[model samples]
Target: MSNIELNDKKIQILEVAEKLFSEKGFDGTSIRDISKMAKINIAMVSYYFGSKERLLEALILYKTSDLKLQIESLLHENLEPLDKVNKLVEIYINRINCNRGIYRILHFELTSKKREENLAAFAELKKGNLKSLETIIREGQSKGIFRTDVVIPLITPTILGTFFHFHMNKPFFQELLHLNTETLYNDYIKNSLTKHIQQTIKALLVYEN
Candidate 1:
């Protein structure tokens, strides 16, 4: 469901759940914790979402709704292929950078065996995004702006993996690079990291033998 469809109560529960899930894993956080943090009755939580798994799915839907719209808009834009890629990289970097905690919860849920039932929703979200990226790549190929020999499945993961890897290793990177302030670090991410990802994707898509 879109953010517009979410009522105040649902939004409250989701915000609480995201914070708790980020601090404590999905398995570690309970419905009661969410209700308590949201200052609502336990029954209210149950009324809104039948179970914790369902609540997680709802959270994923809420967070990704805007991202889906952004990707669709980018796909329909009349910009050049590389420009589209650059915009997409900026989108991903900004989204991930802003929502690092929620993404950590997502990574935990996807990698761990904690909540298998809830994973279908997350998987579908990922599949839809990959399909959009593939569509962009196909459009580029049709225009002879991108190489036809590239493997489509690997493309999304490469970009995502690179960004996530850096995020997960933020402290190490900060130490290694001697970044002293959050502003400096974030600027590096928005500028240097963004440029690096764009260059990587463009190289993959346009490089010729």
Candidate 2:
């Protein structure tokens, strides 16, 4: 086949595989299922991606970078620390609130054992984001704008983890907490989550710096 045709087919295969895997979980989806869903031969899946493991890697690579670029753009700006944090949270909620496919795929990939190269790539991405966050927290503390005791490493995960769990696990929370999918969770994401994170930081306030 032509190079363009080959590339398109590869993208098609990846897109289909990503959606199926996100919706069905890793074990629940198969190469044949991907092939059938893509309307291509099973051989094509193996040909383009080599193996199911590699396919999963490609999916992880695709999904993991969605928020990374956004974070990078925010960090490059001179916005205040508080605005930066809010923008990050807003982007986080906006992504999950709109394209749930990304949230689902990313959530699944977080549980998988990806290849070393993939892991390293993610570690670098994470390091950049963490550095941005740490920069903001440290700056805020220095400016007497935030509590000096607000630990980045400690609450960083809690803030992000809470955002991920609540935004990505909305369906389960609905089934578990009887949350109103249409209105209630949206409210919580905007008001409750944002406020909780802000208040958590407030606890470390030094008043006099």
Give all TM-scores, in the order shown: 0.91, 0.72
Which lDDT tens digits does candidate 1 get at residues 1-209?
A: 22336889999999999999988888789999999999999998998888887888888888876787898899989998778878988888888788777788787554777565556877877888888888888888999889999898887778778988987798998898887789989998999988998889888989556
Q: Against the unseen true structure, what C-alpha lDDT does each candidate score?
A: 0.83, 0.68
The number of the candidate with the highest TM-score is: 1
**Which candidate comes out best when scored by lDDT?**
1
Q: For model 1, what is the C-alpha lDDT against the true structure?
A: 0.83
Which ten contiguous residues of candidate 2 have the minimum total lDDT?
Answer: 1-10
Positional deviation of 111 in candidate 2, in angstroms?
3.5
Our tally of clashes for model 1 stands at 0
Candidate 2 Cα outliers beyond 4 Å, as residue runs? 1-8, 99-118, 164-184, 187-192, 201-209
User: What is the per-residue lDDT of model 2 for residues 54-118, given as tens digits with 9 covering 90 to 100?
Assistant: 77666545655667778778877888777777676676656555656645554455545443454
Q: After superposing candidate 1 on the true structure, give the runs of residues whose Cα lies further than 4 Å from its correct spot.
A: 1-4, 114-117
